[model samples]
Target: MGYCRSKDLDFAFKVFEEMALKGFKRNEVAYTPLIHGLCVARRVDEAMELFAKMKNDDNCYPTVRTYTVLIN
Candidate 1:
C-alpha cells in the first residue's frame, strides 16, 4: 500500500505477487490498493482485470469502497 501510495506500481505489483507466492490469503484488503493505484496511474484496464480476478476468487469480493475506487 505504501508502494501504491508512492506510485511505485512495479514494486507494488511485485509485492502483490509475492503475497500470493508466500501463501498470503489475499482478500479485498489486498486487491483494493492495487486497483486504486492502477486507477491513479491511469491503468484502468489492468485495474479492471485485477478487479475481475478479485471477483472470481472464492474467498474475496469487492467492497463498496472497491467499486467506489473504480468508479472514481
Candidate 2:
C-alpha cells in the first residue's frame, strides 16, 4: 500500500513478486490502492497492466470499488 501510495512501482513490483513466491494472494482491496496510486501519479499504463493482471489472475478479482476508483 505504501509503495503504491508513493507511486513507487519498483518497490511495488518487488513486493508483488515476493508475495507471489511466498504464496500470498492479493484481492481487490490490494489492487485498489495500487490503482489509485498509479492514477494519482498519472501512470495509466502501469495501472492498466495491473488491472489486466488482476483480470487474468484466477485468485484476484476486481470489485465495483475498483472500477469506481479507475473511473474517477
Candidate 3:
C-alpha cells in the first residue's frame, strides 16, 4: 500500500505477486489495496480485472467498497 501511495505500481505488483508465491492466502485485505493502487494509477481496467479475478481466480466475493471503487 505504501508503494501504491508512492505510485510505484510496478513494485507494488511485484509485492503482490511475491505474496501469492509465498503461499499467503489473500482476501479483501489484499485485493483492496492492489485494486485501489491500480485505480490510483488510472489503470481502472486492470483494477476491474483484479476485482473480477477476486471472484473467478480466488473465489472471493467483492464487497461494496470494491464495486464502489471500480464504479467511480
What lDDT score belongs to each candidate, Candidate 1 first? 0.95, 0.82, 0.82
Model 1: worst 10 consecutive residues (lDDT sum)? 19-28
TM-score order of candidates, best first?
A: 1, 3, 2
> By lDDT, who's the top model here?
1
Put down candidate 2 lDDT per residue, 1-72, tens digits, no spaces: 788767696788788778779988877877788888888888888889889989988777889888988898
* Reference-based TM-score, model 3: 0.84
Error of 3 at 44 (Å): 1.5
Candidate 2 clashing pairs?
none
Local error of candidate 2 at residue 70 (angstroms): 0.8
lDDT of 3: 0.82
Kindly list the per-residue Cα lDDT of model 3 for residues 1-72, writing each as its tens digit. 688788888898898889889998778877888899898788888998888888775656788987777766
Which residue ranges in model 1 land beyond 4 Å of their true spot?
none
Give the CA lDDT, 0 to 100, for residue 19 in model 2.
79
